[model samples]
Target: MVIFSVLYPATPGGRFDQAYYDDVHIPLVKEAFAATGLKDVQVFKGLSAPDGGPAPFVAMVHLAFEDAAAMQASLAGPRGAEVSGDIVNFSDITPIAQVSARD
Candidate 1:
């Protein structure tokens, strides 16, 4: 299995509006992600810093896939492109994406 994560740094004074994101954005992303082989999805908001520094990101997203190939395929697929657009509207900056597995 593989998990795709995205860390989105908030703008200088930006804060995420959970209500809108959960009610609108997430559903759109979920629909788009489903078309790109998404298995499960999780979203989180950073409340505080564990490292004694200001939290760099206001939001984080986790997406589970069957494997690395599946994650890659999904991101490169048309539906993924559509989903990516949602990110732009949701955040002040581009998100940092990473992948991990059982390894």
Candidate 2:
């Protein structure tokens, strides 16, 4: 399995609507990528670091896919564009993305 993670770095005065992310954005992602072998989606909201300092990322989203090829195919389609464009609706932070294989 492949896990695609998108991390939103914390910034001073950053704005993230958690409600919208959970209620709207996530659903949109599921709808957009479900057919391309998307298996599951998980979202994390950052609270604090080990030292009680602010977390590096305000939020993170992990998407599970059947394989790398399936993930690539999903991203190559129009749905990818739609998903990417929807980011502005909830947050102002530019997300950093990573793809990983299950250990």
Candidate 3:
């Protein structure tokens, strides 16, 4: 399987309305990707940093697919466009994305 992971750092003085994200944005993304050939997805919030260090206050999102081609296909699909539209509402800063293969 292929995995896409993202780390989204919020802007300085950032304020996130969790209720909206959990209720609206998350569902929208799930539903949108459902239209595509979405295999699996995972979302997480930064609660604490390792070694008690300061965390980045990031939202970590992970998407799983059958392969790189499946991931690309989903991104190029119409539902991908819809999910992309909601990105701006989540964070003010750009995210870091990477792909990995299962061992």
Choose the strongest candidate by TM-score: 2
For every model in order, what is the number of clashing pairs?
0, 0, 0
1-103 per-residue lDDT for model 1 (tens digits): 7999888786786655667777888888677767557889899987768877777678888889888777888888777777777665655566788988854
Runs in model 1 with CA error above 4 Å?
51-53
Where is model 1 poorest over a 10-residue stretch in terms of lDDT?
85-94
Report every candidate's CA lDDT: 0.77, 0.92, 0.73
TM-score of each: 0.80, 0.95, 0.81
Go through the candidates in order and give the C-alpha RMSD of each one to the true structure.
2.2, 0.9, 2.0
Let me know the TM-score candidate 3 reaches against the reference structure.
0.81
lDDT of candidate 2?
A: 0.92
Better of 1 and 3 by lDDT: 1
Of 2 and 3, the candidate ahead on TM-score is: 2
Clashing pairs in 1: none
RMSD of 1: 2.2
